[model samples]
Target: MIERWLPAAASAHACALDAVLFGIHWHMLLIFTAWLALLVVILIKFRQGANPEPRPTEARRLWPAIAIGCVVIGDAVILTTLALPAWSARIAPPPANVTPIEVRVTGEQFAWNIHYPGPDRVFGRIDNSLISASNPVGIDRDDAAARDDIGLLNILTLPVGRTIVIQLASRDVVHSFTLHEMRVKQDAMPGMTTRTWFTPTRTGDWEIACSQLCGLGHYRMRGELHVVTAAGWDQWMKDEQVRLTR
Candidate 1:
């Protein structure tokens, strides 16, 4: 039943995340069932007709303490056994031998700004003072590093089976960068840069949603993420480089 509600896992790390979520939901279900059963028992046993006169409660404080203790233990076990380990693995640095595809995502009022460091693999300088409607990210064209930079609006393309690191920021307010298929979500905050990484295990298109409410147009802030083959990625990069130069 839990699996039915979950989005399809498209990233290497998504299965682990889904497992954690499944465990949490199952735990919550069990707790809810136990509470509901107890409520029914208490209501039936303590009905007005069952006890003609008010009596001192026989319920001991020990039971409540034990229940609270059980809940605490359950939470501790889930955190230490499932959540902590998964989080540790997620935040661990990528292997030195693997070169991840890096992209910069900047959130605005109603759009996502996707920036790729062209063939050089070096991000160019961005000047806020030079920001304009046309130059949203303020890439200084005079800088050599900026010459081949590719700036895109609302489209993120990456290669399957390769790790992708996205440096996230916001131009206006806080926005959460969410890719449901990838099981990745991070807050893009103004004046601060955050990062999240994932390895695409499938080749397809997915929605990139702003999970946080930032402004009046927050509901419309959306983008697309396309995962393609390595060969396709190479061809796309070449085409983008050519387009940038032109």
Candidate 2:
């Protein structure tokens, strides 16, 4: 219910993440109401016409202090029950029984470089010197492994129902790779690779944005995320193969 106004939850783990969001909002609402009620009671009991003098310290009620303690405990409970477990699962490896599709995503100043391993499932060598306006991912075409690798700028396509593992890095400064529909966000730092994985449960198109302010053009740093059905994925693979053979 908390996510109805937000983007479509297109990933398998999206619902779980939404549950955490719901819990937090409801918790805050209860907190606000409790504090407001307490304030009203204090105002009525200590009104100017009734008694202008302040109450003695020993006569003070413990209920107010107890209420504050309860709020703190509730927050800790929420962290243990919802946030921490979801985070642990997010960092967990893909199922060992199934082979996950792997992609290397490099974040530049104003764009995302998507590199796919193609049929071989092995990423090719990348050279920083080869990076340019045309070759954002810096794929070494001379390398046999790189010959079949498919690279694109600001476009990510994945087959629905498959687990995807993405290794992320930055070409320059720090950038955040964010997919709102998938409820996935991770920072890409230069010289160090970060990893994240997700399973697409629905077929649709979504926008990928850089959640961090990296530079002057940060507002325009965006990408396209596409999830396709099985037949559509087959057709895409065939088209890519035909284009690669040429």
Candidate 3:
């Protein structure tokens, strides 16, 4: 299996990449052998003594046709076999049975504001006038939805095998949410919400980084994504809710 070839804590994206790279490597091997054989044949057969009388053969005419046909067929097969699965897993609509946990990720001038919906499953409304260091995201703490909000600078945790829907937006400049293991990367534009989803298959602590440059702190814009078992995640969520309530 493709996953077996990748790291034990590999995400869905990593698995897709592994599948694609495996196919590409196999293609490269075939191409290398074919080209090398062709070169050797040409060298021996086209030499001065080998073919003194250069005959115009129909081989050249069929070569181009054959190459084109092969290209088209190969592309179709590769796209269908390797690339489609990856794209579907990341971009396709979620299954009817899966209930995704929503996480609002807002990119600011220097830091990331990760707002979890607590136990309400709803994000709090934001008011521009209340925006300040103490209330970074302008979250209306009075709103019941925001009362239990656990805002973290960079740490992100998710339950393994559950689809997580991330609503991404930038508060100031452009930013990107990229997790190498998860293979989920999308740009967060100011005043706009970008959605990306991923189901973590492995349990581990992974890096959360901004792949796009927003400002001077771009290099330091780092976070951690903790993927844990369902029971572990439930315990964490319960603890978070209890702490927020206090």
Candidate 4:
């Protein structure tokens, strides 16, 4: 319901997002209602003709102290009950049995570089000057990891149950990597790497878009993420391998 009304700007950190939002929203609604009613009552009860004399100044002074107290205490509870747990879940330790798949994600002037670790589970060094469709990862080819890596742009996919660790970096300015259904979004910054992880429970096609405005072609800097069933993902990988070799 929150997603439909507020619609997450992108995928949220995890399931914890909704809980935190629920708690904060409930408190906010109560506060707003109380404040609104107080304002309405004051307007009606304090008309100039209705009262010959004003209330003592000391009585009004106490209102600010009371209101601030409520606000401060309310916020503390929200942070303790709502925000902290959600943040923890976002950066919590991965379980021991979880198999992590590594992918190097690089953002450039107007495109994305997705490098899949080859059979050796590594990505080869890239040569900028030799970039071409056939050499997507910019792999030296002689390098074992580059030789078998399935590299491409515009389209990417992941297996439904596998946990994916994305090493995000930017070659130019900043850009955001977001996947809506899985609720994972992170920034890609130049000279520093940011990491994001997510395990997709639902399988479907999703959008990979840049949330930040980078340049004239920012809108065009978009792609698709296809989450599939385990068997379907395996088939896609096999197809990619064949495509890379040919």
Candidate 5:
């Protein structure tokens, strides 16, 4: 039922996070039912209609303590067993023997700057002084490695069935890079770089939203996330390279 309303899970980590969420909801429901049952029992046993006179002294019962303990135990179980495992699985180092696609994402007032290292797989130097309307990422095009660098605004294209490692940062203020379908949300802060990795399990196009309220234009801050098949990705890369070299 919970999965029905959520966006399609397009990444490996999405299912793991969903499992944790489902467990938490079930635990909450059980606790609510237990408390409601206890309330009903108390009302029936101690009501004035049932007992004409009430005693000043009350008998100590173990059930209340047990119920509280159970709640505590349930929380601990969820934190250690379900939540931690899912978090670790997503944050773990890239899988062995897998070549991950890496990209740099920088968030500004109302846009996401997409930087892709060309075939060299090495990003070029970024000079803060070179930042302008046309050059969002401040790439030094004269550099050999930067000659093939691809910079796009509000568009990120990735390949399916592969690990994606993102070096996230902010250009001005704090912003959350949110990918709903991919189960990815991370803060991109200024002057600091944060690394996040995930493996895409399906192919689809989704909206990348800025979950954080950065400025007045936050509502209009949106980007496109495209996960395509291997062949499609290869062709896209080839076209981009040809266009750049031409």
Candidate 6:
């Protein structure tokens, strides 16, 4: 029943995230129900009709302590068993044999700048002074490695079944890169670089939203994520290369 409230999980990490969310929701529901029931009982017991005269009541010291202790234990159990392990696994390094498709993402005022290291798979150097209207990421055109570098505006493409490693940064203010389907959210901070990785298990198109309020145009700061099959990704890369060379 609760699954209907969430977006479809499209990445490998989505399952763990969904499980954590469900667990929290269920715990909250249990707590709410217990509190509601206690409130109803207290209201009935202390109603005007039930007790005409006001009397000094003795506090249930042991029960209050027990309730607090139970809450603390519940929180500790959830943190130790669910939250911490999931976070550790998420930040852990990938396996040696797994080759991830690396991409650089730079967030500006109202756009997402995606950089793909062309066929060589090596990111070119960037100069902040060289940033221009046309060159959003300030790619150094004179560098040999930058000859085939591809920069895109508000578009990111990934191949299914392969891990995607994104180096996230911001050019001006802070922005949050959020992908609902993939259950990935990270902050893109200026003067600081953050790394995030996800493996797309399904092929589909989704929106990358900026969760942070950076500027006036923050509402429109969105991008497209195209997850495709391996062959389709290769074809698209070739097509992009042709477009750039021409």
Per-prediction count of colliding residue pairs?
0, 0, 0, 1, 0, 0
List model 2 lDDT by residue over 1-246, tens digit each.
666787898898998888788889989999999989878987887788887676678358698789989999989988999988888888889889988999999998899999998777878888889987666788898998987787889999899999999999998999999999988999999999999999999999999899999999999999999999978877886787678678
lDDT of each: 0.88, 0.89, 0.80, 0.78, 0.90, 0.89
Query: Which digits, one per residue and each the tens of the lDDT, describe model 4 over residues 57-99?
Result: 6356677788879988988988987798778778875567977
**In model 3, which runs have C-alpha deviations exceeding 4 angstroms?**
1-9, 12-17, 48-61, 128-135
**Would you estimate the TM-scores of all the predictions?**
0.89, 0.94, 0.82, 0.89, 0.93, 0.92
* lDDT computed for candidate 5: 0.90
Q: Write the per-residue lDDT of candidate 3 for residues 195-224, one digit (tens) a residue.
A: 988778889987888989888889988888
Better-scoring candidate (TM-score), 1 or 6: 6
User: Could you tell me which 10 consecutive residues in candidate 6 have the lowest summed lDDT?
Assistant: 55-64
Q: Could you tell me the lDDT of residue 64 within candidate 2? A: 70
Clashing pairs in 6: none
Error of 5 at 188 (Å): 0.3
Candidate 4 Cα deviation (angstroms), residue 135 = 3.1
Q: 102-196, model 1: which lDDT tens digit per residue?
A: 99999999999988888899999878787776666778888999877778888899999998899999988899999999999999999999889
- lDDT by residue (1-246, candidate 6, tens digit) is 888888889999898888788878888887788889978987998888978987656354487788778778877887888888889989987667899889999999999999999889999888878777777778897998987788888999999999999999998999999999999999999999999999999999999999999999999999999999999999998998888777
lDDT of 4: 0.78
Clashes, model 4: 1
Higher lDDT: candidate 3 or 6? 6
User: Candidate 6's C-alpha lDDT?
Assistant: 0.89
Q: Model 2 reaches what TM-score against the true structure?
A: 0.94
Q: What is the lDDT of residue 119 in candidate 5?
A: 82
True-structure RMSD, every candidate: 2.3, 1.6, 3.1, 2.6, 1.7, 1.9
